[model samples]
Target: MPAARQHLFLLCLLLPISLSYEIQLILVNNCNYSVWPGVLGSAGHATPEDGGFHLGLGEEAVFDVPSWWSGRVWGRQGCGFDGQGKGSCDSGDCGGMLQCKGAGGAPPATVVEMTFGTDRSPLHFYDVSLVDGFNLPVTMAPVGGGVGCGVAGCEVDLNVCCPSKLEVKRNGKVVGCKSACLALKADKYCCTGDYGSPKICKPTLFSHLFKSICPRAYSFAFDDSSSLNICRASRYLITFCPPAR
Candidate 1:
């Protein structure tokens, strides 16, 4: 082949590799006690930090995931793990394993869900969901400013005022606040069956309370639009027990 043709072929081979980008997720623990952060990736997506790991007060963990990554993260409390990564947590336990692997954390645990962008359309979506319930305060925000990007999370601790019927107690202390749907298991609360649609599944009193407390967070399954945040950033920060503004 001619020299020019060989050079063109080499450039084409490197094009795809140069266009790829990885997103960085920084998980911070600001709680007074220790926490075990759990990560669960979506189908066909790799979980960088899939196994649960320990984070003491003021500690943090950073993970680099593919640009097309999609997953959920949560914090586990009161965990007791053996040397073999076998253990249990008071809240958000993942089958008594230190590393959650592919297993999801048990409720009532505050969950941070995120879906990164693809090369074709580079838009990242993220939200803090209370649909399962809330064990700790969590905030998800882009590391740097991005146009039209808003933060999503619950800054205040919900366990302080959790309704008696919805509180999860451990050692006589409220550790988590269950969503009404989880507490009631009714179609109206769970937004299932006939109530699956947004129009039919209006916010309940409990959801209203949650929204009033944390306007940026998703209080229920149908809570979207306002709760969901879209952005295009290389890095994001998910903080447990986020500091008060």
Candidate 2:
């Protein structure tokens, strides 16, 4: 197997078997630097890890979440905090704190969204979304999901080619690519008010560019048909800076 797959397999073998009743999620940091991962559960769902944690280079954090949980995960970069855990990140900050709690990550950050299986249905739905924009290269894939299961993410770094108007820079380096909606704030770009409907909301040039590059991720709010992935996996892997295939 390739080195990346081999690493994933080794990580899977290390998972605890006692979490049979819950779904397992492994957040791996394969980047050269450390990453702070933020988690936020949907309404009525429980947030795990108190919503945030740190993962050093090549490190991984494992969680056994409720089987019926639904949440989103994103990475925060260039962050620092005091003893009180009060600070901010260059990208994807949440309430200027180390732990995001229930707050969502700021836009221009790559996001991994998931809904695990419930008692009534064994299907689990997940996807990597760029609708908010892109700050990191991330991937979400099933560890042992059965046939037809697909990976959802943008493996390529979008900041490198981000449009000048939509680029978010820190220290003279491009760190994120803002979505058209965020950069323009127009009803047409945001698909709000009269453009809220799918019939009226169409992909802009920027969204089309995003879609062309990150085909498996949501480029716009109405991008659902092909971006969503449904499966039945007890364990899923979310990796930051996933090695290029």
Each prediction's RMSD to truth:
1.4, 10.5
Candidate 2 residues 1-245, lDDT tens each?
A: 99999998987886534333588999999989889999999999988998998899999999999888999999999889999999988899999988898999998899999988865577888999998999999999989766557999999999989999999999998888999999999989888999999999999999999999889899998996778999877889999999999
- Would you list the clashing residue pairs of candidate 1? 52-100
lDDT of the candidates, in the order given? 0.91, 0.90
What are the per-model numbers of colliding residue pairs? 1, 0
Which has the greatest lDDT?
1
Worst 10 residues of 2 by lDDT: 13-22
Output the TM-score of candidate 2.
Answer: 0.90
Cα-lDDT of candidate 2: 0.90
lDDT of 1 at 87: 71
- Which regions of candidate 2 are displaced past 4 Å? 1-20
Residue 5, model 1: Cα distance from true site in angstroms: 3.7
Best by TM-score: 1
